[model samples]
Target: MIQLIECPRDAMQGLPEFIDTAIKAAYINQLIEVGFHTIDFGSFVSPKAIPQMRDTAEVLEMLDLHKAKSKLLAIVANVRGAEDALRFEEIDYLGFPLSVSETFQQRNTNASIAQALETVETIQNLCQTKGKEQVVYLSMGFGNPYGDPFSPDLVAEFVQKLDELEVKTISLSDTIGVATPELITEIFQVQITSFPHITFGAHLHSRVEDINEKVLAGLKGGCRRFDGALKGFGGCPMAKDELIGNMATEVMIETFKEEGYSLDLNQMELEEAIKLSNSIFL
Candidate 1:
């Protein structure tokens, strides 16, 4: 079965306005019933860095997890954040963005590539002890605008390093929405073939028009996991001033259905969540 990860946190984080905690929770609570494999709900990062998500803990508290079929995932930038997320038994996964580009690594997490890898190792150990899983996002996995060295081999090397650390899932992230369909196919094909044990996912950012093509390319290259946000609402604030939105979840659902994939999602609940997103995002 294809794993569809709904990323509400990604949709909300880049917004300049602070969404009320109650509203955030309400929107996410609606998503919880949508039957996504996982919901990327919130982050445990520093409030100063992402003020919009300052109330992540509060949001979690409001969720009706008793009825939730979707697993909860939270983003954490450092060990402190990981520790904070681990405190919540409700969170099933801790996600970290480990950029392949040295420049983006520092920009995104204020750490070098080596430092970030070390952090990943530490976080992995922490997750293992806490009985939670860690998802490492290979940010700038396609290519960066910063003149950094990029190649399919470079991505494979990073995947190799993460594999050594026993990271079970790695999502190749297109931080700047610059990846071509060709690049997506190449990288996913290489990684999926090379690392059979590790689950490779696509966290692609793209123009609205390019969403179907990019997602199709990843599927063609053997990617079964994908990350998407409702209505393509948000992007990495640290990447650039003009954020490129995430792959739209609704559009992705259409594509996946057309491709004859049956997703375990409630159409009624998903429609409700989409309506809720319009209210929260606007």
Candidate 2:
């Protein structure tokens, strides 16, 4: 069975206007009923970096956790953010973006690659103490536009280092939608083959036309964990050049259905959530 991680936080963080905390909670509460494996709901980072998510804590407090079967995941950029997120016992996963490209590592997290590794160590230790699982997102995992010498070998080295740190869940992120189907298959095949114990996920930003090819490539390469946004509304605003749209959750679900996988999502609640999304976005 595949694990679907619905990324509302990513969809919202790049928006220009702040989504009211009540609206965020209501939408997320409805999403919980749809029974996703996990919900990437919010972030605990500098408000200046992602102003739309400034009220994440307030939204979390308002969620009806008693009705939620989905695990909560929050994005964190540094040790302080991770520490802040850990204060909430309701959060099950703390996701940190560790960019393979030095340029994006500094842009997204304000740290170089080496410094971010140190930060990851600190955050991992803290999560262990707080009983929260740490999820490291290998941002710019496919390729970077900054001319930062990218190849499948570079990705392997980064994953190996993360594995040495004992990070169990690593999501390979195509931050700029630069990944080709062949590239997706090759790297995922290598990583899953190398690290049998780790959970690998594909977080791809894509043009609508590339969705099927990319998603199928990841599946062909043995990835079962995937991340998606409700309507492909958001991407890394901090990425170089033009920002790309996220993979649409509808497409992912449809693709999986065609593959004969039963996700067991509540169709009625999902419809409600989609309507709720229309209200929150824009």
Candidate 3:
């Protein structure tokens, strides 16, 4: 069975207009009822950086978790953000982006690669203390346009360090959609084989035409966890001039179904969420 993680926070984070807190909570609440394994619903970062998600805490309070079966995950860029997210018992995971591309690492987190590692160590310790799980996203995991050196070895080394820190889950993020099917297969296969204890996920960004190929490659390489957004609403604004939206959840669901992967999703609830998604993103 493949685990699907729906990422509404990634979809809304880059929007120029502010989404009402109530609306955000309502949409997320519907997603919870749809029965995804987890929901990446919001972030606990500086308001100045992502003004759209400033109301994450408030939105979280409004979610009707009484009957929702999905676990909640929140994105955090620093230790401060992690601390804020930790205060909420509703959040089951804290996601932090740790880019291997030196240029993107500084641009995304305002910290160099070394500094980001230190932050990860601190955040990891904090998660352990609080009895919460931490998910590290290796941004630019496939490749980057900044001309920074990237290879399977570099990625392996970074994953080794993360494994040493007892990081249980790491998502290889295609920040700029530069990954090819071959690259995706190779990287995921190596990571899965090398770290048997660590759970690896694919957080891919891709053109609509390339979605199935990318997803297939990841699956073939031993990845059972995937992250995507409804209708593929958002991408990393800092990566390029034009945004390459996230992996569309609808596409992933359809593909998995055709491939005989049982996802345990409610089609009625998913359709309702998709309809609601248009009102939010369109």
| Candidates' RMSD to native | 0.7, 0.9, 0.7
Every candidate's lDDT: 0.93, 0.91, 0.93
* Backbone-clash count (model 1): 0
Which portions of model 1 miss their true places by more than 4 Å?
A: none
- Residue-level error in angstroms, candidate 1, position 185: 0.7
Of candidates 2 and 1, the better by lDDT = 1
If both were scored by TM-score, which would come out higher, candidate 1 or candidate 2?
Answer: 1
TM-scores of all candidate predictions against the true structure: 0.99, 0.98, 0.99
Stretches of candidate 2 off by over 4 Å are none
**lDDT per residue as tens, model 2, 178-202:** 9999999999999999999999999
**Lowest lDDT block of 10, candidate 1:** 273-282
Model 2 residue-pair collision total: 0
Clashes of 3: 0
Per-residue C-alpha lDDT of model 3 across residues 32-135, encoded as one tens digit per residue: 98999999999988899889999999999999999888999999999999999999998999999999999999888899999999999999999999999999
Candidate 1 vs. true structure, TM-score: 0.99
How close to the true structure is residue 59 of candidate 3, measured as C-alpha lDDT? 97
